[model samples]
Every structure is written in structure tokens, then in C-alpha cells.
Target: MADIRVLIVEDDPFIAMDIESAVADELGDKAELIVVGSVAEALRATASRLSCAFLDIDVIGGKTFDLAAALLQAGTPFAFVSGSSPSDVPKALRQARFLRKPFSTREIATFLLGAISPLKPRRSRNH
Candidate 1:
């Protein structure tokens, strides 16, 4: 596969590390992982090219919908990785893809794989 440039936005250190580990284990050096802990930074960083993004709903002081909107406008697909329920997500993002928290590496790996893969039927990855 070509280089998979992935962005991960999460405030929790442990959770961020888990995502990083999973991506690293799955893609090794083929993955370029960008991990940020806040929504503001994630938004600014989204201006660059990204293969995909893993965003948390609740970040430090802001929600991720703004960045989600930007990614959507730019055609960069992303997945919401949060413990929050789908109802808690903004209406505009209610239909966006998601990967629930307390997730296993396999789950993360699977989501990442699908996110960067060829187009398929659009649906949330609730697992």
C-alpha cells in the first residue's frame, strides 16, 4: 500500500497510545501517524493532506464536529473514536462513521483498514 497518512485526535494519553500502537502494529513504518490532543490543533493540521483521521468527540475544551466538517469538506474520510453515543454526536455528524471506545487493537486496525481502503457502501463502524 502507499503511505497511509493518519491523524489521531484524542485528549487521553492512554487511548492515544493504544491507537498509535494499533496502527504501528498493523502498518508498521508504512503508516505516518499524527497524534494530537486537542480539537484546535487537529483542525489546523487537517489543512494538510491526510489519508484518514480518528477523532474523539470530546476533546480538551472543544468538540470535534468542526474538524469533522473540515475533513468532510476536504473529502478526507474520518472515524469518530469516542465512548459517546451516536445521539450525543451533532446532527450534522450523526451519520458519520464511528469506532466506540474501550476498543481493541483488532477493532482499531479493522476501522483503519476500511477507512483507507477502496470505496464501499457507507455506514458507521459501530464495533
Candidate 2:
């Protein structure tokens, strides 16, 4: 439970890093955070072991819903960290927790930790 790995997908590098920094600050050394600027990178990262992911709904060259779908299909647990309004989120993933922009590190850490909690059950569901 201590080593919570999270991937953040955002088009803006600065914002992505900010979220990563926040996770580190809140979780200290226990947080393993990875930040990517596009859905492609996020998809690639998911091939490895991940506790959770904070995904943006819209990217410059990619769609967030597609990424969410891939995660969902793979049974990977995730949350949304977006500037978009709730109504803008895809119908399939509307149930996930959303973290608005300018969120604190503590908030990101808490979200990641909580999202990862369901992964254990996800493993069972897949099997």
C-alpha cells in the first residue's frame, strides 16, 4: 500500500510535473509518479505495473475517452484529473473521481491511493 504508482496524462508538461510534484510531496517517498504529455505515452506506461492513473479528458493530439477505454478494458483502475466539467467527461467513465485543476499535492496523493485500492478487486474480476 505504501508504494502507490500513478501516471498523469496532460498536454502541458508544467502542469503534469506539478501534479507529479504534488503527489510526491503528499506521499513523500512512498509515491511513484509518472507524468506524460499525451495519451500515447500514457498507453505505453500502462503496459507495466501501475497502481493508478490520473487522466486528462482532452489532449492536443489524442482523446481521453479512448485512453480511459483502454484502461477500463485492461481492468486498470484510474481517476480523472481534468479541467473539464463533469458533463464533459465520457458517459462510460463518469463514475470515476475527478480532480479539478489547481489541486493540491495532498489531494492528488489521496486520489491515487484511493484509486489503487480497487485494483486488487480488479485483478480478481479479470481472473
For TM-score, the strongest prediction is 1
> How many clashes (backbone atoms < 3 Å, residues ≥3 apart in a chain or on different chains) does model 1 have?
0
Which stretches of model 1 miss by more than 4 angstroms? Answer: 119-127
TM-scores for all candidates: the values are: 0.86, 0.77
Candidate 2 contains a number of clashing pairs equal to 0
Over 41-122, each residue of candidate 2 has an lDDT whose tens digit, in order, gives 8878888877777888887667778878777887677777778788888788887778888677777778766666654334
User: Each prediction's Cα RMSD?
Assistant: 6.6, 6.3
Candidate 1 residue 36 Cα shift, in angstroms, is 0.4
Model 1 C-alpha lDDT per residue in residues 1-127, reported as the tens digit of each score: 3367899999999999999999899778877899999987897777778888999999986999989988888888788999998788878876678888888888788878888776433477895
Q: How high a TM-score does candidate 2 get? A: 0.77
lDDT of each: 0.85, 0.76
C-alpha lDDT of residue 8 in model 2: 86
Clash pairs, model 1 backbone = none
